[model samples]
Target chain A: MNVSRRYFMILVPAAAVAWESVLAGTPEDSPNYKMQDHWWGMLIDTPKCIGCGNCVRACEAENDVPEGFFRTWVERYHVTDENMENPEVISPEGGKHGFPAAKEDEGKYFFVPKMCNHCADSPCTQVCPVGATFVSPDGVVLIDQSYCLGCAYCVQACPYGCRYINPEKHSAEKCTLCYHRITKGLTTACCENCPTGARQLVDLKNPKDPIHAFLKTHSVQVLKPQMATGAKAFYNELDGSVR
Target chain B: MAIFKDTGHLFRFAALFVVGTTSIFVLRAIVTPKSFGQYGHYRGAALKDLADRPVKYAGHQACEVCHTDIVTTKTAGKHAGVNCEACHGPLAKHADDPSNTPAKLDTAVLCVKCHAASAAKPKGFPQVQADDHSGGLACDTCHKPHDPAIAAGGAK
Candidate 1:
């Protein structure tokens, strides 16, 4: 009886510790989502954007993004004929409340909405020491908050200024391409709210997706091609002045 | 006898330390998730958690169910493919209750959201300088929200 009691004392706590670890490791449930089947991307038609700021607002509401930080934002660029290369760009409050009336009529103005490019050869993923940030099988870059060490390496690596350390979570955060919604056969909040159909969610693997035809026809270019990040956000009618 | 006595305590301490370390490793082995590194470095369970979140936007079909007349008129116009909530805002509340009327949209501001002139826009696409076009008149004065073609012609 004494031997059995001693064994029980030691074994019970060990078993309990093991069980707790198992619970901690429990993953969120996703059923019937095959990662190999989809390669997701976005096509932003710069000409179609009117800069209403609906996409920015929708992204914040959907993601619970904090103020002064942006998962997505709209930049209004005004380029004059005299200085085409030096365009004036501004995004007041991340363009959540829409833009004010243009100040100068001499310049040509257009709005460009920016977000995570979800690069295939992402610099952010490469710099994460813990692999907290990684590209998913469907071409979306995502962060695991649980595993993140709150290091800012990913933030520095992003050339487009997409990432920020989430103030509340203390983790590096950026656009997931609405991973939660897209995996379940729904479009992104930004795409859904865009009035002009300026933003479109594309599935590259799906041969029937209209992006195939659009790519064949339109002169689409990714942001910062010099970075060679394999960025998937295709911009149609991107102005030469846009950085 | 003196050496044996001192060494016995040291052996006991070493055994305890090894046992404690072994137990921790055993626990970790049992608790670690099986599908953690299946795709890349991220936990596979995160995908499921994200998928389970409630959808916010009420899609085009939901609006079409009740507002058939507006849908018919819109379908005949250029903005047919545009979802109703693009202008109406999120309809989760309005969809649940018919009495909750959505706020009226300002035509001047709303129309320019897509129609403002920009050199980056295609040459053929309809665009106007908001201040110059119609001399600061509201867009609705010249074009109807639902059927602009009929409003412009004033016949048929």
Candidate 2:
């Protein structure tokens, strides 16, 4: 076939773009898994947690998280009986090392495991100048790292203080709730390593999930509910004093 | 001929508008990723990028398939809920390659990492002072890791 120079240039570029999509092939680890069928979230049972720091350690190893940062961390809250509102909380080294014995054998002490709340009305998504951060179809908020501007807008917008800029990559990083693992019919690193059944990755759409039943019976609360971010990380026996 | 000359400026402005709009559309079509806006506002392929990324921790169920003896012991113990990878670290590679065994971890140090007395821990949960619990002896010396309450000899 005879082609003019103008037509040839257009044809080559068009073919190049088409070829890239063909190579992409929509490859997924679990090809049969459907995102629409699931709405992902997490459950934290505070009473069950032993504060062993297993979840924190497992997340770092699983995600290749840099040192002095955390994807998930345990915070110890020591609330006095008299002044419940004035609780002393500490998360040294992102709770990687278990805390020392309590100096004050006071009113009540417990560990609160914290991670990205994966809000439905996420401020992080709203503030992204490039819209690199967005909500996934399965109700999980995710970041397209390649498109991220590393402006740290998401880091600042997050009320839970979950998001942080990866020092080396300089991109906003937070808990994905282990999207890579969950899509492949696996639980998160944090939930999997939790020895006491303190954490469980919940599929809100799945009727069989125990979360639905647990929610019915328990008083569930998200951190900073006043912000009204629709945070999906549910906490059972959440102390009113927790900040 | 008189009408054409009078409306020449208007025609020129219309032509520029057409050309400018067409070029903008072409530029967007060229630069935009094929998968953009396929799922949401972001690139659709990002979802696949995450879903396809390799995992390090082979769930405890994977280990149970091969090491039934060890897993059986663990399942019947205080640490039954603890996944194998929690203590073993990421062993997805080892699960595939039998030759690539995980390094022998020091039980003394490993046990203390979790069991050491922590103020933050729940009261019902077990805690110990490493020095007081053992006179510099490995935890596994007396307490079987799989079943901590049981002695190494299968005696409680």
Candidate 3:
């Protein structure tokens, strides 16, 4: 007996629909589905940040971040096209006082907080031979220190140079987006303490989050978008000339 | 011939078991929360509400109500972005009793929890080895949280 190709095609889709319906109705014993597509991210408004470096201190205090190392750091961008050769980006050793004095030029200056961009297409995650580095369902990039061979592949693969191997822990380390705090339902240490609310942790899935609305209303751009790692961290008011 | 067939079946079973055991080990590595990798799974208060649903935490604003001066100084200083709760353990107890002894954000103890001394120090920051910095030095000994200036005030 020959079966019609149309009938077989219809049967496959129908069976798939039935299977999906059954799975949908069945409550998952292990709720791993809730962990999907979570990308914890930040929106830094340079115009509002005021160069106070409060976020830096707050991050240190919150996560007990050590001296001489940073989970979250700030970068001060100075644009001087008039003397293009002399134009430079100055990140005065510590970000505590924000940016150092910009030279007397018609150029512009702004403070940009830098950390793991937590790209969705994260190069750090891709280069981990031991699978120590990964992106969370919520979109934060993380390192599993125990599994980390400390091979430093993640460090090299990262174009932004965010990853570093901690010699003390004998493992790789990077900004965690305050995972311990954020998981406990607290705002990220940096976001909560931002006096001017210049920095914000946003849920891309939540339409109510002011960040979603802001992105929709404004033309915010991600850094190094050309790398096409699809960074979750977005910035507003950065001059196109700065890049 | 029957004995040979039986031996072959046993060999296949053993191979399957070995593969299964190896797979379980690999899966464990993938699923385990190793180091800061688990940070990506940070489930903020709102998301936690969707999970087990009982945990609660206070925002910095709640602390600022009573810590007005501390909060003011913190906001105006470099430490403004640092939350009162970050240094202080938890606020619920303090919120419940405003007179409760609060935690201090001072010292290398605060810094060491995260910024552990690397075998090699980065730039101007001093080496914070487990033993060297493990002793009496507080974070404030060399650096000020509110100001970038190295504190001559020393660790209190």
Candidate 4:
């Protein structure tokens, strides 16, 4: 058999094309295809939040959040006057409950629940050296424990101050939006537990969800939007004084 | 002599080619081996595929048939939704022997299978070990697993 140079050239390109196809299609072959639909995010209406800390308790009970480390926290803002910069100032202890009586000299008090922002451009994700912290295609930021090296860069770089270095696992961990639960068609424990309906999970891509409609009707903005991380969590009627 | 030499060369080339191809095939098989276990094949099955046939329970209602009251109590309560099979292991043997009492199923140990103890779930609320469950407080004493009601104060 006379092997032609033309045929050899053709064969090489064909093999390369075949390998590329396999690589491109590898993820589709996975069993967990429904993972694509999951864009785990939350919306908080600061105005609606009663600061009852029901969400905090619910999350703790449901998910088993530890004593020192909280999966979700609330910050209380005390704006004295409409213009004055000096407020009462009592952002204490993650505010598992409402602020302790608004520092005795209360004017205007409100609470903001804080958790993993699950930023589109997460600084925590970018800083992770081992590629453990990653944003999924649906926009939920996450940590893959199987791949984590426990570098703690994710813990340090999180602007929202959510990620923590888990001492027991020796790995950086944070609110994964209850990925195991969410993947199973269940809502996040925090969202499920909120009695006041202050917290709402919404698909940003879906126009039909109340979150999108609310964002349109009322002026809603993300915390530290100037940071430009494109954080999915939005606060409705955010207190300008708190910023 | 030339003819013999040519034939010998052809024979060596043929042997090398056969050995090389066989070796490559064997190496590839070893490197990218398929799953061998029976469970491995079913991993990709959809819910409908899994539930196509009634589960093999051997015509025995098992726990429910014997413990109607417990089943009724559990079902009416919070744990009513939880499948009995989730806690109780396969029941074919248990069904066969009514006299053979089941060893006390450790509720704490069983709950841990779903809720792994992690930083997020630190207390491991449902999983009560012997020390954790002692002091007139078995897991069932405080928590009626079948029906975990949100009590007036709170469900502990």
- Model number with the top lDDT: 2
Residue ranges of candidate 2 with Cα displaced over 4 Å:
A1-29, B1-6, B151-156
- For DockQ, the strongest prediction is 2
True contacts kept of each: 0.42, 0.78, 0.11, 0.00
lDDT (tens digit, per residue) of candidate 1 on A1-243: 455888999999999999988877733345567778899999999988877788998888778889899999999888887758788898999988777766446768888999999898999999998767888888899888777888899999999999999888899989988887887777898998887789999999999999999999989999999999999999998988888
Q: Tell me the lDDT of model 1 at A104.
A: 41
Superposed Cα RMSD, model 2: 6.8
Best-first order by DockQ: 2, 1, 3, 4
lDDT per residue as tens, model 3, A1-243: 787998999999999999988865633233454455455788987666555566777666655565667777777666667544443565554475454333344566666777778898998888777666677667777765546688888889988877676757767777877766566556776777665567889878776778877998877888888999989888887666544
Consecutive 10-residue window with the lowest summed lDDT within model 3 chain B: B41-50
Q: Give the CAPRI rating of model 2.
A: medium
Q: What are the per-residue Cα lDDT tens digits for candidate 4 across B1-156?
A: 465544877889999999999999999678532421112211122211212322212121456777788777775665554445435533435567778555778755444433322222113133223454454344555565666564722256
| Deviation of model 1 at A22, angstroms | 19
lDDT of each structure? 0.82, 0.86, 0.64, 0.61
**Candidate 4, which segments miss by more than 4 Å at Cα?**
A1-33, A89-93, A97-106, B1-156
Interface RMSD of 4: 14.6
Question: Poorest 10 consecutive residues of model 3 chain A by lDDT?
Answer: A26-35
DockQ of each: 0.33, 0.54, 0.09, 0.03
Candidate 4 colliding pairs: A64-B120, A64-B121, B77-B147, B78-B147, B79-B146
Give the chain B TM-score achieved by candidate 1.
Answer: 0.73
